[model samples]
Target: MRLEQALRSGRHLSTADPTEAELLIVNTCGFIDASKDESISVIRDLDSSRRKGQQLYVVGCLTEIAEAEVRATIPNVDATFGAEQWDAVAASVGPASANFDIPQPEFTNIKQPSAYLKISDGCDRPCTFCIIPTIKGAMHSDTVSRLIAEAKAHARDGTRELVLVAQDSTAYGEDQGDREGLATLLEQLSEAVPDLPWIRLMYAYPGRVTRLLAETMARLPNVVPYLDMPLQHASPSVLRRMKRPTVNKSRESINHIRKAIPDVVLRSTFIVGFPGETDSEFEELLTFIEEQRFDHIGAFTYSAQKGTPAATLLEQVPEAVKIERYGRLMELAQSISHDQNREMIGQEMKVLVESAEPTTSADGSPVVIGRTYRDAPEVDGLAFVKGEFKPGSMVDVRVEGALPYDLLCSPLDFHKP
Candidate 1:
């Protein structure tokens, strides 16, 4: 978002091909070793492919973590800026065109049914495996008024859904000493943009998911009954080492959320093969997955990030062991997800159309592709709706079939605005 805002004043335009553009800006993610490697690969590929006149610049988390190293390794890069150095980036790129007007905060060129509103940046939690806090700095939330303004702007721009995002969403307002900050912000947004049908929350800290926040979700008509709390592991021993909430506490928190929103679609992420994670610990996590029966689960092999404390920890799980655990965890998660999806076979859902491709249905008609409230943009599953509808149209769909991660739906009615 900052990059987009900074570029708004420039006469230059964005292009997908580096060779065609005069300047290319790569926003890199360095959250883990895997992401860092991917970033390096992209930079190298772009550098190799670019024409002589094309300039390359690197920014974001990776730059923050190792600007000097990036400059040293990638000598072709014209400049590098840290994660928070938007002003410096703009200065390096030159001033915006005189005719340019500052774009609305929520405006974007991307076409989608939903938009993301980042309410806060950075993190304060001491999760040993994470480099976010070190890279992005301490937690800082946008004012409630500012967030409401952005939400209203997005609504004006035809955004049907808004996804509130932050490093720890539930911890909003705590830095400013207001315990009910997120709840208050939600209330304001609901009133300010009643036309937006769906308002989703992501990256909520389990420990900070207060009763009031859950109740706010329950009471708000626009707020979807979905929570994405990334529980790294279920073993108390592993949780303690990672500096996360204990297993018992996390379970209590989940129970509280479920109680508040009985039909809530609970989504969580788990990391397997953290340093010193035992076979017993893995079993505990697997058992928790079975018992919890989360509507959606994402599991990944732990990556020992270079600067994080976990990288230096003893008894680091072998790569083969991590991969094995990841596979087994995903298999179990898929079974649970399939069962959960199957139960919704006869239900009616409101699906927001995302894209429509020309394809023949069972009876030889065309259909559109979309997602229901249960699915978040990009990360979760999609719903294949059998109907003719434009992207961003919300339609009522009757569940016809189920896959492990996606749903097959027959359109009952189109709700085009």
Candidate 2:
């Protein structure tokens, strides 16, 4: 989004084809080893294929973590900037067009119904497996007033759903020592932008989720009952090695949240094959998953990121073991997901229409693709609706059929409330 803002400020037109553009901005992610490899591949590919006079700038987390490596290895990159250096990037690209004024707080180029509002940046946590703190620094939150203004702007610009994001969402305002910061912000945003249909929260730290926060979510009609708390592992021993809160604490937190919001859709990610994770520990994680019955689960094999404490831990799990564990975990998660989806059959849900393209179903009838409140924008499943609707419109959908991850629905009616 910063890149988009920079381009708009410079009055540069976006091109779908990289070959057609004079300058290509490669914003990269360095969250994991896999992401880093992918970013490198993209940079190399773009550099190799660029026409004469084309400029390539690499920016973001990858640059922050490995600027020296990027500059040394990718000689075609004209410059590299960290995630927070948008001003330098703008300066390198020249000034804003005389006629164009940069929009404040909101991106005018964004036309999606769902938007991510990053209320805070960076992290202060010492999770042994994470390198985010090293790359992005400590937690810094935007003021409540500023975030509220941004939320209102998003609503005015056709965004119906807002997903509040941060490295540790529940830890918002702790840097400034306000314990009830996130709760206060949510209340203000709800009142300020009543038009936004769904306000979802992600990347919440379990320890930081105060009772007031949960209560605020339950009270706010727009704040959808969904929580994305990434509990990296379930075994107490593994969690200890990861420098995370105990598994008992996690269980207690989940139980409290479930009791507070009975219909809450829980989403989480887990890391399999953490160092020294025995078969018994893995079984413990599996049992926890079975007991929790989360609406969505993402399982990943632990990547031994460089410069992290876990990288040098004893008894590193083998690659084959990691792969096997990942498969087993995902297979179990799929069964749970299937059961959860099947339970929603014959239920009515409010679906945010994503795409209304002309496509015939198996019976040669047209259908639309949308998502329910339970599904986050890109990471989760979609709802296929048999109806004529405009993109970004919300409508009522009756689940006629269910797959393990998606829903086949018939449009009931257009939803106003």
Candidate 3:
């Protein structure tokens, strides 16, 4: 949203140095207490800095969460707008505001080869531990036409890979009936940009991955065979308390996805501790994770979200217990991930070269660093190679070594299809 605002307003801003800018605006994500404090501190710094030729505006979820409080507490801010008040922010910028080319933030595989396009905003999940529905309100998916147009723009920008992001990608097109579902959207996107080699989806709900949706992924050549399904918790009792679908249904959904797409890379996240969760319930979760060794697993310890129903529940898991459980889950995931990667050794894999690792005096030689379809930019691991492969070029890689999170390999120069 920040980048879009700057692009629309035709303004250039710098995170490196702000003392020289005329108008300064800070976009804040005050979803939690810590984030709120950080926003306040930034606002206070801007207020106290009192730099010449500088103005400040505040916007984002923080403003929506505490609009009045922010205004009164941070009077130094010239203006404040909520999540819905983008028009006001756009109007605030005058002719003097500048603009710069903003590339999407990609931590790895960032060889100017990948781009991220947000297809939708907000979520409809009623999870008791989430604030997305409260802050961003109900489902509001972007139209398929607009998404295709934006994606085409990226393709023209020389983006070979595009990652689709949303609060809930699987809930796409739910707001409108005439819109064919996510499956249709994927099929349309594949047709829209046949030249763009790779298209990936992120943050899709496991429950929404219907059989047809799984099949669409299999049918679309450009779409990578990977799924990022964040099932916060797996125990049926805990899932019900969190307002999630039945655990058995989620399991069946996974089964269908794997059965239909044999090579699918499954990435999922879980919350180790939630309010009212007993050790026995957590043991159920541990057993569940053991059974489902997801290709990529991320775990987080539960924290209190102020406006969430989970926050008010009694028997809140202690911080110590949460950390302990979180540690155990991570430890188990490391072992499982290592074992999973070990299975890939010596297998020929297709990797999109993303960076060129320079050789130093002590280092052996230069190599093309990149990622496979299984890895998402920044969030997942990477593959390192040392050979003639060029950055931003696709190459065949033979996995020579594998670790819990990183893959090491050498390029196959002579191998031909």
Give the per-residue lDDT digits (tens) of candidate 2, residues 298-388: 8779888788999999899999999999999999989988899999999998889888474679889788898999999888899998867
What lDDT would candidate 2 get against the real structure? 0.86
The CA lDDT at 307 in model 3 is 88
Candidate no. 1 TM-score: 0.92
> What shift in Å separates residue 76 of candidate 3 from its native position after superposition?
6.9
In candidate 1, list every pair of residues with a backbone clash.
9-96
- Structural similarity to truth (TM-score) of each candidate: 0.92, 0.93, 0.84
Cα lDDT tens digits, model 3, 1-417, are 434544344443344367766667778776656567889999888878867657888888888878788889987688887776666676666434334554443212123678887777888788888877898988887888888877777677567788988888888888876333788889999999998888998888866788888888998999999888888788888998999877887787798789889978888888878988889888888888889888888887887787899889997898899899999988887888888888889998878887755442237566667888878888888887766555567777889899798798776764455
Encode model 1's per-residue lDDT on 1-417: one tens digit a residue: 667666654544556666677788888988877778889999999999888888899999999888887888799899888887877787788864557554534445555579999999999999999989988889999988878877887777788889999989988898999988999999889888988999999998877777888898889999999999999999989999999988877787788788899999999999999999999999999999999999999877998877889889999999999999999999999999999999999899898988746466778978778889999888889898887788888888899999999999987754454
Candidates in order have lDDT scores of 0.86, 0.86, 0.79
Q: Give the residue spans of candidate 3 off by over 4 A.
A: 1-6, 9-26, 30-58, 66-80, 97-111, 178-180, 356-364, 387-391, 414-417
Candidate 2 lands at a TM-score of: 0.93
RMSD in Å for candidate 1, one decimal? 2.9
- Of the two candidates 1 and 3, the one with more favorable TM-score, higher being better, is 1
For model 3, give the RMSD to the true fold.
4.7
